[model samples]
Target: MIGFARTVRLWFDPREIRQEGVTPDYRFSLANERTFLAWLRTALALIGGGFAVDQFLPGLRWGWRVGLALALLAAGVVCSLRAVNHWVRCERAMRRGEDLPVSRFPALLSLAVAVVAVAMVVVVLVGWEG
Candidate 1:
């Protein structure tokens, strides 16, 4: 368990974590933590939604259901990875007194979810037996 914890910490940021040049404002750090948690929650929800669609949406075509599940699962993976990278970048910027980095992940996530929504609409209008 101790080793696992260490691994998780390193996963969050290997090089810059406590290569912390200095501690910045605690409020900024707290805000960063909250943002990370929010992204994590969103990722979890996407994963759960994918599972629910796979399990509960019996009227959907098999191909349509699988496609939706795959898309949501893929998006969740992308969100999780982006969350870690974002946390690392934000923490590094804070420690160095530099501008925080921006990520295109938010736009990527939006686009992905929008595409999934449109696909779902088409699926509903098409071969859905119910």
Candidate 2:
């Protein structure tokens, strides 16, 4: 889709973002960058958790192991993409003097993580050896 392609392009094209409106306050931009970095850190943690689940849980049944690992990996991928997209949107909004864009991603991501935690608890209690 055109929208998806444009989003991908934005990730690599800083000039496109800079072209939008005037430069925002340095402090606001720095804050946005910090938030972006935090999202990236969270993504890296999720990715690492996925790898750990796959590599360290050899005793886990193949189905559960693959499913849980894949879920975490997918979440990490989404979070990374979202981090860039959100950064770009927020930057543009600030430059244009518009209210910062809002997203439901944080709530959705939280709910997803909670679901994963519950699943993990079930898996642990059920015992991999069984």
Pick by TM-score: which candidate is best? 2
Model 2 per-residue lDDT at 61: 89
Candidate 1 lDDT score relative to the true structure:
0.83
Q: How high is each candidate's TM-score?
A: 0.84, 0.91
Q: For model 1, give the 10-residue run with minimal summed lDDT.
A: 3-12
Per-residue error for 47 in candidate 2, Å, reads 0.7
Candidate 1: count of backbone clashes, pairs at least 3 residues apart or interchain: 0
Deviation in Å, model 2, residue 27 alpha carbon: 1.4
lDDT of each: 0.83, 0.91
lDDT of 2 by residue, 1-130 (tens): 9987887798899899788899977999999999999999999999998999889888888889889999999999999999999998888889999999889999999998999889988996796685
Candidate 2: residue pairs that collide: none
Model 1: how far is 8 from its true place, Å?
11
**22-126 per-residue lDDT for model 1 (tens digits):** 888899899999999999999999999899879988899788899899989988988887787678778877898898987777887888899888888788788
What is candidate 1's CA lDDT for residue 92?
Answer: 74
Model 2's alpha-carbon lDDT is 0.91
CA shift of 57, model 1, Å? 1.7
